[model samples]
Target: MILIRGKWRTASVGFLCTLLLLVFLATPVWSLVSRSGDQIIIGANEVIADDLYVAGRTITINGTVNGDLVAVGRLITINGTVQGDLLAAAQAVVVNGTINDDLRVVSQVTQLGSNARVGDDAVAAGMSFESLAESTVAGDLAFTGWQALLAGNVGRNVTGSMAALELRSNVGGNVNVITGAEGDAPEAYPPFFPQPPVPIPQLRAGLTVADSVQISGNLTYRSPGVATISQQAQIAGGVLREELPEDETAAPAPVTTIAQQLQYFIALVLVGWLLFKFVPNWIQSLAAIASSKPLPSLGWGIVTFLAVGIIAIAIAFVTFVLTALSAITLPVLIFPVLGLGTLANLTLIFGFLLFVMFVPQIVVSLLGGRWLIHKLQPSTSSNRFVSLAIGLLIFVLLTAIPVLGGLLHLITIFLGLGALWIWIRNNRDRAPTEPQLAAV
Candidate 1:
């Protein structure tokens, strides 16, 4: 019996070690070519059989990728072929190649060169997007951006929300657009648009349909002003102009004023300063834990938020039932039941408010500050106050932006809450021993 037990123990230990090894080395079992550098180029003669993942300042693919191609960089250019989906995020993305599957890109400027062809749908979002005359999309085209110039061939529908739109394309299906208000168009073309790395045509800030356009289906647009449609433009299903909804037609509320922003910034700084002063070590540890495993922290953060909300609702329902039962059958138990219910509900409310008001901003700011400091001055010892100040300022400025600010705020909330949960869980796991505090 002893001999058999020893053999089993050995096998279990070996298996555990193998599992740990695989976990630590996170490379996928499938074929993948992942690389990051200042610049990444796949030469014309090169062909990758596996999925390609690349991150760099500049990424140019002149060869072929049989599997999906995912790229992140400042500038991305695809001059070859991607047999699978092409997903890219960059400052500028210019595609002059062929994508056998879908093409999804988010960038400051997304341009489909004259020769560019997408076998499937094309979805894009950014400051500006243009599909040159000879470009072709075998499926639908969807875009959301400041400006869009489509002169391509779309097999299906063309749909988007844009400040300005110019369609000189041949659409096999419908064309639908929601454009900017009538008087919102600037006096000059590209008035607010940033200069792209690659040159693109200047477009006026309203919908324009040129004579070259041919639509097999209806041309429907919703705008405060009428669209500019050339007399010769062909629309098989005719044109329809939809009225703006009442809510949309109404004037928008003013964004936060300068005074309001200043007050918010001051309040945040004060709160952050007090927290750092009282619990420096705790703050540092939380930041460190979150930074150590960012992706996991984000995932856990989302899960925790959902769980907390669900649990809160359940508690509320149970409390209501218990209180009603006590009131009807046992008057004496009513006080106790009501008291407990009120206490639990109050605790949950306060905790949620605290997290929403401060935790996310503080955590995200601290992390950002730490990164910036480390990058700028690697040799200097990190000071929590300094980091918090720097990060808070940056956060305030960024969050002040319209659309982008809202997104950043949401992300920070999740990431911050996730870090806090992770730190608390870690402390609980080490309840028997003194928790080790790591410096930020």
Candidate 2:
């Protein structure tokens, strides 16, 4: 029983490694993920046998992906066929290919070329979504964006929440829209028949259906303003519009202001005080190591940053592929796998955020505190608040600077991270070695 317990414990430790890899591959790869001029391109004649996952500044796929294609970059263009799902996030997404399955995208601008065909649902959110007249979607078109211009044929429903909509298409199913508040009422023109145009209120969001539109199913919409439908617009099932209440619809929050900065200062001071009270020694040690080995610390910081990122990508690729396989061959194990995958994703997100937000601040402040104490050569009777306050103030000021302040912020991050990494590594090396067993 004792031997069996030991084996199980060892297995658990091994399982933890898998979790780390999965976490690494998760979303936090955004840090050190993309590099300018490092574009990944699939040539026009090439073909990929398996799944392709890529991250860079610009990515273009002109060949064929036999499996799913997942990409994150500044510019993404797919001009070939993806035999499986297409998942992409970028500044610009242009699809001129055929997607055998679902097409999902998040970007500043998304364009589905006239020749593009999506076998399944086409989901996208961006500043603008344009489906040209020649495009054909075999499934629903669901979108949330600033503007949606549809001139294509949708096999099923067309649904979107947008600021502006231009529909010149045929929908086989329902048409649902939530328009924004930036549309003007149609202008009055003198008609020879002598019927004056009635006055109407300005719409925050406007919906326009051209004469070319044909909806076989019910047309539903929720908007603060009314839609403008051309006389020739055909709707077999009629239209249903629910007016959105002013109170129920919320606007975006304002940008950061001085009040928010002051609040942040107060919160930082309180948090620093708590950290000081409980972990003074650890903080001091990190600062001391950082100050003494500045270059080494910075180097280690870069290394650690990259190592975590690479590990994460590997994990994500492995997890996705394995999950797909398990869903097919070992359905019974899917739940446990999904649970682990979720945990891995959370770990990556939280860990990245922790380092990005807290570690740098703590390390830099601690260094500033140490520097202040040394410069003043204060007596034993001196208050610790003076040093803490000075450190926090310096950091805050540096962060406030325009362009140069951004550089300082980055430096401070490296200094702190490098110092922490060095300290941890040294301590681990200094730990006592396990005792060797002697034969009985």
Candidate 3:
């Protein structure tokens, strides 16, 4: 029993440690640092020399970051400087300081304050993007969202796809926009008609160029109606309009056929056979642990499953950051990045297939088979092969039953996974120092 417990603990610990090691190895810990919390603030006097990664509910960067800054939060405000590129995602983003490189942001509302400056391109995607007067983007400005109010200056082009674009700015190069067409105005209700308590602001679609705007190059736009260009606005090149394409309809989800089910069943059977043939003892031990303490097993399984998902996400996010770094700085790092990504992907896929898709079902079926066999034929109850077969057959059949099957399958997976997790945790440190001299 001690030996069995030790093996279970070893297995769980080994699997978790392997995933942690992979993540630790993949990250560029020497060059980057990270922080997360409910509210994160980088004080004005503080400075981070390495690339910074941060996530929180509210994030404020008043200090200087000598390297790239990547942030995600509910409200993000950068009041100091970023010596390198700035990549941010939040509900609202306000940049009032300087970014020596590109600024990439995704948010509900993105604002470049009057003192804001970007040494390179400024790319933003959100519901509304506003570049206040006096702010400047040294390179091109790109935006994709519902409304864009450009009152600042652009060193190069201004390109965007939006519902409403109001430009009261200066562009050194071309201005290209894809904006919405004018929709029918709301019908006027009778004077005595009751109106809604709160008034909803409506957006007037299409581009609106103010008299103060200046474009050194051509103006190209795609919209159903002509753009509103002020006569006082300066444009060195001619204006061109392109036709807008119609929206594509989404396709319906594909239904799983009977053949797919048969194939899946066969695959599970083969996998079970392999496990039964090589790790029969391990299987029986896990079943025993699960049967003895069902609740604990279920709880552990839920935690493990969630942990695995979080690990996979972390791996993917790290891969993306590494790929970006390789592209920006060290091109040679691409080889290692690719290899790491591939390995991580394979590991995650295998883990999902084994733990989520197969292990739970197998464990539950085995337990069920043992229980049913003991009740029906006590003499043959110890026959592992016969027990597994009976359990798996019944499990598969019940899991094939329409609505109830899905719920039952889900419950079985949770229970099985929990049992495995419990066994590992309970026995990992209980391994015997030497071979047993006698059997129980």
Best-matching candidate per lDDT: 1
How well does model 1 score by local distance difference test?
0.74
| lDDT of candidates 1 onward, in order | 0.74, 0.65, 0.69
Candidate 2: tens digits of C-alpha lDDT, residues 1-440: 00111232233323332322222123322221121236888898988887666767788889988887777677788899999878776767888889998787766678888889999778776556888898988887877655678888999888766666778889998887776543543121112322212121222246888999999998887767678888899999998888876543322211233345567667667766776688756666665666556678778878877777887777777777778889999988777777787678779867875765665666566556544344234232334555566566646643542222355566666766787777777779995322211111
Residue runs of model 2 more than 4 Å from their true location after superposition: 1-37, 182-204, 247-440
Number of the top TM-score candidate: 1
| Candidate 3 CA-lDDT value | 0.69
- Point out where model 1 deviates above 4 Å: 1-27, 182-194, 245-343, 350-440
User: What's the CA error at residue 153 for candidate 2, in Å?
Assistant: 1.5
Worst 10 residues of 2 by lDDT: 1-10
Stretches of candidate 3 off by over 4 Å are: 1-25, 183-203, 245-440
Q: Arrange candidates by lDDT, descending.
A: 1, 3, 2
